[model samples]
Target chain A: MGAIQGFEIRRSSASLRGSATQLRTLPVVAKYIDTSTCIGCKACEVACQEWNDLPVSQTEQVGTYQTMPSLQASYWNLIQFREVDYQGGVAWLMRKDQCMHCADPGCLAACPAPGAIVQYQNGIVDVDPEKCIGCGLCEPGCPFDVPRYSERTNKMAKCTLCVDRVEVGLEPACVKACPTGCLQFGDKDTLLAYGKHRVTALKEGGFAEAAVYDPPGVGGTSVITVLRHGDHPEWYGLPKDPTVPVAVSLWKRILHPLGFIAMGAALFGTLGHFMTVGPKKPKDTSTTSGGEV
Target chain B: MSDASVPASAHPAAPGPSIMRLAVHREDVAVGDEIVRHRLLSRVIHWVVALFFMVALLTGMPIYSPVFGWMATLFGGLSVCRWLHAWSGIAFSVASAVMVLHWLSDMKLVPHDLKFNLVQYMQFSAAEDPEIGKYNPGQKLFFWTIPLVTLMVLLSGIPLWWPTKFGSTLRQVCIIVHDVGFIMWFVAIVGHVYLGTAAEPGTFRSMTRGTVTKAWARLHHPKWFRDVTGDRKE
Candidate 1:
């Protein structure tokens, strides 16, 4: 882990949920991967595990060249391979799949444990294994399905967007390991500008669907992917307009506070009855028949 | 007609409880002014269900979200909470089923309950009706709905307990249902507890001692008092 320099935490799951008094001093950082230039090399995936000292998981072949099919406990980054019909011929659409690090992270909002999932000032979502209880609530909380539960330690694990190296003024191990100049790391605004330039170049090269895939539904993400067919994110195993589930929002925003209030109302009602009506005393009619007065 | 024909002032000592009712708790013998209410078996089952509900609630809270992580410490930790909560939930479901079966006969709402104005009853302005029996419509409603809600919670919980067995979409739906069910259950139980204890004094003793005062029965349920005492008119 790199030394965190004046980087304040932005949001934490299950905090007292008050406005943060402390503010961030560091620049908002981002990671941009051009899926159009990716060559399906597994170097980034290898770099991620080696840099983090994460375990190597043995995954079964699931009829796909995309290694392991999906993210796993030990594997934070994966290259997803999909065969798409392009230019009247089949083309292999390879993508680097990892956490999106959403500004409004569903995992953070859906988390029940304090400090389990958190976003730092530099725009990286990370999970604290000690705080993670392995409930897997964050599993469905994620629209991309990134977090994986470790059976060994009973906690959730996910990509930190290489927070360690980036904090120390170094690019993420994946960006450093890319064979082509397909991966870039720097200020988010600069990357977005560069991404637009690349998208224009791609469109001129006869890729009509070339566009940026930084979805704004979840308030955008730190990690942006440049898809050749961005209009159809489903082809890349991505939701078209991904947002946090309504139930998660409703539960946290509405039900959580309302439930406590309702319970309080119940208690107050009972006490009011006691104070107003008191206990109903049973009548005493020793010699009387069953007929009451 | 035998006791009916007797003069109003000439009533003999109340007949002893029926010997056919062999269950000790079912013996409705009026020892002076007190009469048996719930049987011992019924009370035991009710508490067992309550115990398991609390256990499941506390353990499930940790797994539901990290906000309730402190609760995990009450048990061992989240590891122990996981299996403990699941087993307790299953136990609660089974116990609720048993309770529903045991009390089904008493919970059957007859035509008289339709005329039993619940609004007036809640307002504490209801006219006394001799047709009212052991359990009122309100109590019957609680008995019926609790089992249904418990079943709903169990059904929604299956996918969450085993994620790989189901798809991601189904798991998302289950999470919503499970959470909504919990909120509803929490509200219902709070009202039920208040009604059975502080709101209605002497009600708790029925489940604890399996009996109530003759005065309490006569005041709350005159028809039931007459039925047990057999003070019929000729």
Candidate 2:
């Protein structure tokens, strides 16, 4: 029994070490939107607005059945329509538009307000209302043009991928509302595998650009898309290359800390001298010591 | 002009008004007015900046997430939050711009200040350099960055507000530019808050009271103290 116990202790120590090393190699979750299977159903769009309680958008007929024209403050999600010629056959391409919830979200990176926008542990992008400061810095950073500024509230608004619901083991409102079995959410690895499988299946069915739209750039989007035609990603209004600007990184990594340190030092040093020295004394007082003159 | 006419004690007497020797320092100099705390105008501007910042934040939260969708109730609803966020952003940018203009004169980077890099200043162990002055290099840098970052935010926000009005490529470029600018601005402001409040003891008073003690002035800005007091002490 003693010998067996000693062997077990040795084995457990080895396993603990291995576990520690494994902990350091946490996998980065890649979120994506699969466009290949997405039908032109407006379920995702309706679900987004309804759950968020966003006001109905006032849109006009602009030669297409697409409502609300484009994404707006009240319209967090929109089903985009693009008529493209695929092998001489006109196909109406559909995509649900919202914040990409990117791994390297430009919106989170650009927001001037601390905690105004943040990326959650599960790779969902969220906004902190208390810290937003209505600077609208996140609006342009998104390649998808996800954020919309509200004039009335003087703040920026966008889809948060139902971060609250996702955290508590619930599907996003839009994902749940998707009746066509088009929108699916799962573990990133599983999703990637499933997306790949779908893409292979679509390619066999004669869709050429039936590949994945999750690029390594922009640190890879959390929302991945498996599109029917690769060429049509742009047509659906997705950027080929999304990246955090070098200027921003330089400012954050170098300039900001430097400014804080320098300023802090100057403030402290100057104040410290004044408190200690009091006022300047006469040169003759050097010999006075602690005694009164 | 006529040093010979003055008594020998006058030289030593000039450095009086020391808090340590109350009668000595207080005899000649009045130590200026009971340090004028932030005047009405300064207070107004400061509070306005703060108020607009809060307004912007509340309105912006719902747009970022449905979790904060509860924040939408503050502004009637999420639709209201959306519109409020954009307009409030404009308000913030404008307020920041006005602040820059208000403090422009004080914030100038003089030639003497060029030697005062933030890195060297942060080395707390070093003897306080006499070259330090009112509003050190770091404060100046912060003041300058506010306007530049505000400009970046405004420029990037415009295209996003109306994407179709701008070409798709231009909009993409704007998004990148805007996002990068916000990140940089956010980090800087964090440091600014720390320094303005908890980092330094008497620093917050400069913004609030609008006046600093003679000792504080002399210690932090020896040159300014000397200039104000006309005392020359090695």
CA lDDT, every model vs. true structure: 0.77, 0.61
Q: What fraction of the native interface does candidate 2 get right in terms of contacts?
A: 0.04
Per-residue CA lDDT of model 1 for B91-162, tens digit only, reads 999999998998887789888888776556655435456666777777787788888889889998887776
- Model 2 is docked with a DockQ of 0.09
TM-score of chain A of each: 0.91, 0.75
Give interface RMSD, every candidate, in order: 2.5, 10.9
Instruction: For residues B115-224, write the lDDT of model 2, one tens digit per residue.
Output: 77675555434445686655678889888887888788778778766633565456556655655565565457556765565444455665554544555555555665
Question: Which stretches of candidate 1 lie above 4 Å from their native place?
Answer: A1-6, A17-24, A285-293, B1-27, B61-73, B76-82
**Candidate 2 positional error at A24, Å:** 14
Q: Per-prediction DockQ scores? A: 0.44, 0.09
Q: Write the per-residue lDDT of candidate 1 for residues A76-165, one digit (tens) a residue.
A: 999998898967998788888999999889988877667778788778888877767676778778889898876677777889988877
